[model samples]
Every structure is written in C-alpha cells, then in structure tokens.
Target: MLGIGIVGLGYWGPNLVRNFSAAAEAEVRCVADRDAARLQKIHSLYPAVDLLSEATEVFQRSDIDAVVLATPINTHFPLAKMALEAGKHVLVEKPLATSRAEVLELMEIADRKGLQLMVDHTFLYTGAVQKIKSLVDSGELGELQYFDSTRINLGLFNPNWSVIWDLAVHDLSIFDYISSGKKPVAVSATGISHTQMGIEDIAYISLFFNDSTIAHITSSWISPVKIRKTMIGGSKKMVIYDDVEPTEKIKIYDSGFSVSSPEDMHRWLVDYRFGDIAIPKIAQTEALLGVAQDFVSAIVRGTRPISDRESGLNVVTILEAAQQSVKQRGQTVSLV
Candidate 1:
C-alpha cells in the first residue's frame, strides 16, 4: 500500500484527506496542520491516522511515500521542495507555484530525485471534464472555435492571490486539458481590487490562440449568485457544461453558423444551423478520489497523470501572461 501524508487542513485539505483515505492502493498515514483546532477536528473524525502540527515531521516519517500539499498558493513551492528533497513524491494544489520559475525549480528537483510531481487540478479527474475531452478528441465537437467560462461566488476572496489566480486557473486548466489545437499565444485582461489589500477581487481575461480558437474567462468574488458554467463552440456542435447542476451537467447542441461572400458583390451571406441537444450520461464518482488514485498510481508505476507538472506549467504560462496584461490595463501580452 502507498503511504500518503497530507499537509494543511484548510478549505480543500479535508477533502483531500477523505479522498486519499478512500482511494485504493493508498493509506492516509498522516495529516498536518498548524492550527490546534483543525488538528483536533481531524483527529475526532479520523482517529486512526496520526496528526502533527509541524509539516517537516510528516516528511520525516518512514511510512509516508508521498506528501500532498494543500497549503496556500505562496507556500506551495517551499513545502513541495522540502518534500521532494526528503525523497517523497509530492502532489500540490492548483497553480503549482506563484510563478513559472518556482514551478521549473520544483520540476527539476522532482526529475533529479526520480519522484512523481503532480498538481492537484482536481477538475481534470471529473466525469464532466473527461467526457468533454472525449467529445473534443473524437470530433463530436469538431474544430472548436471558442471557449468561454464564468466562475463566480459571493465570498471567500483570497487575501494573497488575485481572483484570477484563485478562480481563473480552473477554467484555464480545464481548457488546457480539453483543447488539442494550437495553444494560446497571447492574453489580455482587466481586473479590479475592491479592498486595500491590492489583490484583485474580480477579473476579465481573454486568450488568443495561434489558431482561430479563442477563450474568455470572468472570475469574481463579488457576484450575488454562484455560477460555474463553460461553453465550447465548434464547427459541428457546441457544448454547455453547467457544473452547478446536480445532474445533466453536460449538454451538447448540434448547432453552428456559416458565412460566405457572393462572387460579384462584397456583401456576405450568413446562415445558422440549429439541431437537437444531447445530454450524455456522466459518471457520478467523486473527482477527488480519481485524483488520489492517479497520484498514487503515477508514483508506483512511473507514469504521467493527466494533471502533471507540464500541464500545470502550461496553465501557469497563460496566467503569467494574463497577470502582465492586467497590469497594463488589459493590453494584449504576447505569450512568446
């Protein structure tokens, strides 16, 4: 059995513990958090697992083959580096690190130590995303032209990271996984800081690809109603993925448009096509469980998981560009 150690029992940490415990081929050996209250709470729920306030103690353990870091985005690099140097496989939460340089350093250490390094982009493991990938890969949604998403909630504004870093990463990661065409070459963004913290609480980001494909993401912490919706339009069919829906999360529409210019005149003719909507069945399994299983499997089998370090870097690359663009008041920033 693979021994797993988890650090940080904050928002998503407990869910990581629960999923890792439930995953096959893995044992939740230990969990660490600085807060005494969080430790006591976890102990009350999972009495069999050991607890520690110091993260290094968990890394020093003999049984822990891998360490999962659910700490703040800023602390990801140092914790992961320590775990890697300690000869432990590391699973880090989204964005990997604050910058591309940090991610590169972690990737280098993991490679040198022959350890499995993965980012916990949990949505990639979801049934909805997997199905969307299949549809795009199979040409069910032929020649994807645009991808648009909106992820917003009323509260939980991050103190350290911007709204783009906290929320836009999800849509970016999802787009990175599902799209097989030319990667994004530039980004343009505009954001607002609502508080004195100077951290962006709301943002609108747009990505330009080498191909005709384009993507737009709107992330905010000030919306009155929570929404998680993505739209992917293609030449043949379009997809609407509403993560808020308990069931029927994916809806495929056989809809598209066409335009052509006459030989003699300069005006163009436009036509639109509308067809039936299909809602394919999606697996109801917990996405976090899949993330746990894949992380463990990658370590044991020496394979690449869906959300590998490279994928994380790709998403971060876009984010880095978006950050620069936002600083320039939505000026387009070239990726290359």
Candidate 2:
C-alpha cells in the first residue's frame, strides 16, 4: 500500500486528504499544516491519520512513500524539491513553481532522483475534459480554430497569487492538456489589482499557437456569480464545457458556418451548417479522486502521470509569459 503524506491543510489540502484516503491502493498516513487550528480540525475529522503542525515531521517520516503538496504557489518548488530529495514521490498542486527556472530545476531534480513527479491539474482529470480530448484526437473537431474559456468567481481570492495564477491556470492547464502538446508561440495579457494587493484580481490573457489555434482566458475574482465555462470551436464542430452544470457538463454543437470571399479563388459564397447539439453522457466522478488514484498508481507502477512535471512546467511557462506581458501593459511576450 502507498502511504501518502499531505502538506498544507488550507483550501485544497482537505480535498486531497479525502481523495487520498479513498484511493484503494493508497492511505493518507499523515497530514501536515502550520496552522494549529487546522491541524486540530484534521485530527478531529481524520482520527485514523496522524496530524502534525510541522511539515518536516511528515517529510522525515520513513513510512511516507509519497508526498502530496497543496501549499501556496510560491512554496511549491521548495516543498516539492525537499520531498523529492528525501526520496519521496511528489504530487504538487498547479503552476508547479513561481517561475520557469524553478520548474526546470524541479524537473531536473526529479529526473536525477528517478522519482515520480506529478502535478495536480485536477481539471484535466475530469470526465468532461477527457471526452473532449477524445473528440479532438479523433479528428472529429477538425482543425482547431479557437479555444476560449472564462473562469471567474467572487470573494475567494488568494493574496499570494494573481488572478491569472489562481484562476486562469485552470483554463491554461486544460488548454495545454487538450491541445495534446501544442505549444503557444506568444501571449498578451492585461490585469488590474483592485484590492490594493500586489496580485491581480481580474485578468485577460490571449495565447497564440503556431496553428490557427488561439486561446483566450478571462478570469476575475470580482464577478457576482462563479463562471467556469470553456468553448472550443473548430472547422467541423464546436464544443462547450461548463463546470457549473450539474447534469451535462459538456455539450458538442454540430453547428458551423463557413465563408468564402471574392479574394479567394473559391468564389464569394457563404456556407451555413446546423446540426443537433449532443451532450455526451459523461460518467460522474470527482476530479480530485481521479487525480489521487492516478498519483498513487504512478508511484506503485512507475508509470508517467497524465499531469506530470513536464506538463506542469508547460502550464507555468505560459503563466509566467502571460504575467510578463501583463507587467508590460499588454505587450506581446514571445514563448520562443
């Protein structure tokens, strides 16, 4: 059985503990948090698991085969590096690190240590996203034209990270995973710091790919209602994935219009196609559960996780570029 230690019993840590506890081949042996109150809560709720206020306790434990880090974005690199160096497989929460350099360092360290390094990109593990990836890979979506996503919420903002890193990273990771390794060439972004915090609360980012694929991510913590929606339009079909939906989270629209201008030799004609919108019946499963299962499976079998360190690095690079662009007041930042 895989004994896992979870760090940071903050917002996402409890979910990780719950999921890891539920994994068949894994056990949440230990959980660490700096907050004494949080540690007491965990101890009270999870009586079977050992709880500690110091993260070092879990890290130093010999029984912990793997460590799940749900700490802040800035601390991710250090904690993950320590875990990896301590001969423990690591599962870090999104963005991997604050910058690309740290990401490369962690990847290199994990490679040298020959330990499993997985990023917790929970959205990519969802059934809706997996089904959409199937459509894209099967050529059913045709050549991808544009991917637009909006992830916004009210009042759950983190002072440590910007809106782009806090919310936009979700769409960015989703875009990266669904694109099947297509790298964005450049990015332009704009953001506003509303709360006098150094971090941004609202932001819009545009990612340009070599192919005609362009992805736009808009995130805000000032919105009245939470919006988690993504639309992917292609030459053949269009798709909509709504995380807020309770029943059908993904809907594929077989509707597209084509236009040919006089400049083109094809002649000046407009083609319109309309078809039924099919909501693919996707199985209901918690994303965190799937992520936990994958993380443990990777540790036990020495298999690469879907959201490995490289994938995490890719998402972080885009975020870093986007932030750079934002700092320059929407100047286009080249990824190359």
Candidate 3:
C-alpha cells in the first residue's frame, strides 16, 4: 500500500483523511496539524495513525510515500515544493498556487524528481460532472457554444483570497476539463469588496475561446440563497447542471434553433425547435474517494492523474489573468 501523510485538519482536511484512510491501495499513516485540538481529535478517532504538531515532520518521515496538503492557500506552494524536493508524491488543494510562476516551479521540481504531482479538484470527480464530460466527449452535445456557471453562497468569506479565487476557481477547473484541449484566449473580470476585510465578496469573470465560444462565471459570498448551477449550450443540444438537487442533478435538453433563407433578399426565416429533456441517472459515489483512488493509482502506476500539474497550471493561469482584469477594472486581459 502507498503510505500517505496529510497536512492540515481544518475545513477540507478531514474529508481527505477519511477518503485516504479508506482507499484500498493507500493508507493514512500520518497526520500533521498545528492545531492541538484537531490532532487530538484525529488521534481519538484513528489511534494507529501517527500525529505530528509540525507539518515538517511529515516530510521528514521516510515511510510516507506521498503527502496530501489541505492547508491554507498561501502554504500550498511551499509545502508542495518541500514534499517534491523530499522525493514524495504530492496532492495539493485547488488553485495549485496563487501565481503561475509558483505552479511552474513546483511542476519543474516534481518533473525532476519523477514524482506524482496532483491537484485536488474535487468537483471534477463528481458523478454529475463525469456524466457531463462523457456527453461532451461523445459528441452528444455537439459543438459547445457557451458555458455559464453561477456559484454563490453566504458567509464563507476567505481571508487570503477574493471570491473569484475562492469560488470561481471551481468553475474554471470544470470549464477546463469539459472543454478538453480548448484554451481560453482572453479574460475580463470585475469584483467589489463589501466587508471590512478588504477582500472581494462578489465577482464576475468572462472567458473567450478561439472557437468563438464564450464562458461567464459569477461567484459571490453574500448571496441570499445558495446556488450551484451551470448551463452548457451547444449547437444541437443543451445541458443544465444543478448541484444542489438531490436525485436529478443533470438535465439534458434537446433544444436548438435553425435558420432558413426566405424569398426576400433582406429577410430570412428563423426556426426554433424545443424537444424533450432527458435526465440521465448518475452514480452516487463520494467524490473525495474517487480523488483519493486516483492519487494513489497515479503514484503506483507512474501515470499522470486526471488532475495533474498541467491542469492545475491552466486553472491558475486563468485565475491570474482574471485577477489582473479585476485590478484593471474589467479591462480584457489577454491569456496569450
């Protein structure tokens, strides 16, 4: 089994620990957190696992073949770099790093060390998203025309990053994955800070692709109601993904419009067609478990993971461009 060490026990750390512990090919051998209470709680639940107050101990231990980092956003690059330098595979939480340079540095280290460097983009492993990817890849959705996503909730303000970095990052990853090899050419964004913390609580981003495809994302931390929805429009069909729905999370619409030439030279006839909507049944496996399995498999098989360094780099590049656009007051920033 691949021995795994986890850093951080707050927020999303516990889920990682649970999934890694349950993975058949992997085991959570060590857990490190500065918070004494969190360590105590982990020890109480998992007495066989080693607990460390300092995360550096996790890197020093030779038994740990891999390390999963669920630490704060600012700590990801340093911790990942240290792990890769120590010859340990690394799985880090999303956005990879705040800047493209940091991500490239980590990627270079991982490549030199021949270690598996994966990013924990949990949403990509979700059943709904998996189904959506299948549909897109199978040409069932035809050529994608536009992608629009909205993810907003109240009172989960992050101190280190703005709403765009915190929330829009998810949609960016999703867009990157479903778009396959298509890359965004330009980005425009706008955001505002409402709290005394001086961090943005609401933001909007728009991405432009070379195929004339467009994507818009809206992220907010002060919405009255929670919403996690994405709309993908194509030439032949459309899709609506509502993450909050319990049973039916994905609905595919067989609807589109067509045009016909009229006798008049200046006027043409437009035809609209609305067909049946189909809801595909999705498996209900836990997404974190899938992520854990993929991480361990990548390490053992010496293969690139679904959420590898390149994917992380793409997401981070978009985020960097969006941040620039926001700073320039919604001026379109070129991603080229």
Candidate 4:
C-alpha cells in the first residue's frame, strides 16, 4: 500500500483522512496540524498513526510515499512544493494555488521529480458529474450551449479567500471537467464585501467561449438556505442537477425551440417542441473515496488522474482572470 501523510485537521481535513484511510490501495501513516487538541483527537482515533504539530516532519519522513494537503488556500503552494521536492507524490485541495505562476512552478518540480501531482476537485468524481460528462461526450446533450450554477450557503466564510474562491471553485472545476477541454475566451465578474473582513461574501462570474458557449456561476455566503444546483443546456436536451435532493438528483428535459425565416419581409416563424422528461438513476458512491482511489492509482500506475494538474491550472487561470475582473469593477477580462 502507498503510505500517505495528511496535513491539516480542520473542516475538510477529517474527511480526507477518513477517505484515504478507507482506500484499499493507500494507508494513512501520519497526520499533522497546528492545533494540539486536533492532533490529540486524531491520535485518540488513530493511535497507531503518527501525529505532529508541525508538517515538516511529514515532508522529512522517508516512509511516506505521498502527502495530501487540506490546509488553507494560501498554504497550498508551499506545502505542495515541499512535498514534491521531497520526492513524494502530492494531492492538494481545489484551486491548486493562488496564482497560475505558483501552479506552474509546482508543475515543473513534479515533472522534474517524476511525481504525480493531483488536485482534490472532488465533485468531478460525483455520479451526477460523471453522468453529465458521459451524456455530453455521447452527444445526447448536443453541442452544449450554456452551463449555469448556483451554490450558496450561510456563514462558512474563510479569512484567506473570497466567496468565489471558496464556493465557485467547485462549479468552475465541474465546468472545466464536463466541458472536455473547451477553453473560454474571456471572463467578467462582480462581487461585494459585506463583512468587516474585506473578503467578498457574494459574487457572480461569466465566461465566454470561442464558440459563443457561455457559463455563469453565482456564489454567496449570505444565503439563508443552502442550495447546490446546476443547469446544463445543449442543442438537443438539457439537464438539471440538484445536489440537495434526496433522490433523482439528475433530470433531463427533452425540450427545445427552433426558428426559421418566413417568406414575407420582416417576418419570421418560430416553433416550440416539448418532449418527455427523463430522470436517470445515478449510481451512489462516496466521491471523496473515488478521489483517494484515483490519486493512489495515478501514483501506482503512472496514469494521469481525472483532476490532474493541468485541469487544476485551467480552473485557476479562470479564477485569476475573474479576480482581476472583480477588481476592475466587473470589467471583462480576456483569457486569450
């Protein structure tokens, strides 16, 4: 089994530990956190696993084959860089790094060391997203025209990053994965800081593609109700994925309209077509477990993971552009 060390014991860290421990091809050998209480808790639960207050021990240990980082956004680059430089494969949480340059630097080190660098864009491994990818690839949803997403919740704000970096990164990664390598030409974004921390609590972002395909992401930390929803429209069919639903989370609508020119001048004809809606049954599985397995497989088999470094870079590029646009008061930023 591949020995794994996890850094960070906060919010998402525990989940990573659980999933990596349950992975058949990997073992959790050590955990590190700044909080002594958190380390004590981990020790109580996993006494055999080593615990450290400083993460340097994890990078120094020869027994660890890989390191998984679930720390703050700002700490990602340095920690991942240290792990890669230590001749160990690294898996980090979403967005990879704050800037494209940081991501590129990490990529260079991993490439030079022949180590696997994977990002934990966990939603890409979900049944709903996988099904959407299959349909889009199969042309069932012919020529995807738009992707709209709304992810909002109350009071999970971070001190280091804005709401877009916190929430919309998920949708951005999803858009990047299901789009199958389609690159956007430009981006426009607007946001506001409602709290004293000076970080955005609400934001909206729009992306433009070369083919005129568009994507919009709405994220907020001020919503009274939590919602996780996305809509994908294509030439032939459309999909509605509601993650909050208990069952039948994926619904496809065979509905569309078409327009044609008329014989008379200044006149046109339009037709609307409505067909039966189909709800596809999605296979239920733990997405984090899938992420852990993929990371292990990438390390062992020398295969690229679904959420590889390039995909993470793609998401970061868009995010960087979006942040610039936000700073310019919603000015459109060209990605070209």
Best by lDDT: 4
TM-score winner between 2 and 4, please give it: 4
lDDT of 1: 0.92
lDDT per residue for candidate 1 within 184-287, as digits (tens), equals 88899999898999988999999998788889999999999999999999889999999999999999999998888677677778799999999999999999
Worst 10 residues of 4 by lDDT: 257-266
**Which 10 residues in a row give candidate 3 its minimum summed lDDT?**
301-310
lDDT of each: 0.92, 0.90, 0.92, 0.92
Residue-level lDDT tens digits of model 2 in 226-280: 9999999989999999999998899999989888767878677889899999999
lDDT of 2 at 207: 92
| Clashes per model (N, Cα, C within 3 A) | 0, 0, 0, 0
TM-score against truth, every candidate: 0.98, 0.97, 0.98, 0.98
Q: TM-score of predicted model 2?
A: 0.97
162-271 per-residue lDDT for model 3 (tens digits): 99878998999998889885789999999989978878899999999887699999999999999999999988899999999998999999999877867887788788
C-alpha root-mean-square deviation, each candidate: 1.2, 1.5, 1.2, 1.1
Task: For candidate 4, report its TM-score.
Answer: 0.98
On a 0 to 100 scale, what is the lDDT of residue 183 in model 3? 89
The 10-residue segment of model 2 with minimum total lDDT is 260-269
